[model samples]
Target: MSPVNPVNPANPANPGNRVGPTVHTTPKVPVASSAPGVARPRIALSTVALECPDAHELAAFYVRLLGWEVEREDTDWVKLRAPVREDGGGGTGIAFQSDDTYVPPVWPGVPGAQQMMAHLDFEVADLAAAAAYAVASGAALATHQAADDTRVLFDPAGHPFCLWAAAGAGDGADTGRG
Candidate 1:
C-alpha cells in the first residue's frame, strides 16, 4: 500500500502536507522510567541560587569564604564554581541573582518581617578560626549562638549560615559531625 507520505508516514518532510499521528520529534528533559529493577536516573543538585541586592557582592563573600572562583558574572547575576574535588569532578555551583526587593532574613525567624528561606552549612577544623576568618571577610557573628562548637553568622547581605567544628578536629571532640 502507498502511504500518503511513504518516506515518513508519521510526519512528511513537506510541512504543508501533513499526515499520520503527527510524530513528535521533540526531545524530553530526560527522566528515568519507573520500571522495576531499572537503575534510576541520578538527579544531582547543581546549584543553590540566592537572591540578593547585589549578586556580585554576595558572590564575592562566598568566594572568599570557600576559596572558590567566579565562573561567570554579570551586573545582575553571578556564578561561583566550588573548589574542584580531589577526584577531578566539578563541585556544586553557587549562583546569586540580583533582587531589588530582597530583604535580609531574620534568624530564628520573625513573624511579620522576612524569615530565613534557606541557609548553607559548613564544616571546619576549628570553629573559632573559621568564624574569625568569616568576620574578617565582612561577615558578622550572630549574637544568638546556641551551640558550643557551632557558630552562626550573617553574610554581607544578612543571610545566616553555620560553621561547625568538625568531629575530632579542633578539640578532639565529636561535635556530632559538623
Candidate 2:
C-alpha cells in the first residue's frame, strides 16, 4: 500500500497527536462477522510493528535472529511470521515500516533521551547460545542489564529485546551445540 499523509485534523483534547497512516492488513484467519447493519467490528491484535530507517534491512536481522520467514514485504513495509506449528496454526508475527524520521530509542532511559517504548522477549533454553546468536545477527548488547535471567540487546534499528533463560538457567550456561 502506498503511504498516506500523516496529518490529521487536530482534536481539542489531543492537540498535536499525529495519527499514523492506516496500513491495510489481512487477518491470518477469517473472523466471525457481526450482523448486517450492526456497525460492530471484530478486533484482534496482530503483529507488533516497529518504525525504522529501512524496513527490509531491519527485517533481515530479525529473520536471522528469530528464524522467522518473511510473510509479506514492500519497499516501505515488511512482515515476518514464525514457522507454522504442527497444529497448522500460524505463530506470532512482527512487522517493520520505513520512516525517514525514525529515531532509535535508548534503553535504561535517561532524562531527555529517546526512551524505549516496548520490547520483545524470547524464552531460551540456552541463554548463552541465544545471546551469542543475537549478537552475531547484528544486535548490540545493551550496557545496562536489569535482571540476571535476561540479557538486553538492541536490534539493528535500536529496538531493545531480551534473551531470557528458562527457570534455573539464569546463569546463562552454554549448550555444546557446536
Candidate 3:
C-alpha cells in the first residue's frame, strides 16, 4: 500500500490529531443595527409608494414638481426616479400604484369623515412661487391654512400636500411648521 497522507483525517498515522477538509466559517454580519456607539436604530428610506386612482396623474404632478423622471410606467403602476448626483450615487424613488377603490382624503382631515392616512411635505426655497407653480399645475390651494409659512394644496387627485419655506433656502420665508 502507498504511504498515507498525514493531513487526512481518516489516516491511521495520527490517532489523536486528524484533518480531513478545511471548513471556513464566515463572520456573521448584522443586518439591522444601530449606528456605531448610538442607541437609535439605523434605517434608510428607499422608496415612498403611494396609491392613487390615476397613477399617471399623480406621477405627472410629482414629476413636474420635483423634476424627477419616470423610470417605469404602465397602466397599473408608475415609478419616478430623482436625478443622480455627480458622484454617481443613486437617488430616491417614488412609486404610484393604481387603486380602483381609492378615495380622496378630505381636507382638514375630519375624524368622523374620511381622514388622511398620510401626506407628502415639500420644502421649497420660495413658498409663494412654489404654491403658484403648483396651482398652475392643477393643484388647488386648500382653504384651511394651518400656518402662514406653509401653503397646503391639494393635488388633482385631492391628496393634500404642503409646501413649506425652508430656512437658509432659496428665499427665506416664515419658519412655520406645515
Instruction: Pick the TM-score winner.
Output: 1
lDDT of 2 by residue, 1-178 (tens): 3233333232332222211111235544566667667877677667999999999999999999888989999989999987888999866799999999999986665568896777888878777788888999899988877555667889999998887766666454532221
What lDDT does model 2 reach? 0.75
lDDT per residue as tens, model 1, 88-120 = 888789999999999999875546879676778
Off by over 4 Å in 1: 1-42, 171-178
Prediction RMSDs, each to the true structure: 18.5, 12.1, 22.1
Candidate with top lDDT is: 1
Q: How far is candidate 1 from the true structure (C-alpha RMSD, Å)?
A: 18.5
Candidate 3 TM-score over all chains jointly: 0.69
Residue pairs in clash, model 1: none
Tell me the lDDT of candidate 1.
0.77
Predicted candidate 3 versus true structure: per-residue lDDT over 94-118, tens digit per residue = 8899999988888664556776766
Q: Pick the winner on lDDT between candidates 2 and 3.
A: 2
Give the Cα error of residue 85 in candidate 3, in Å. 3.8
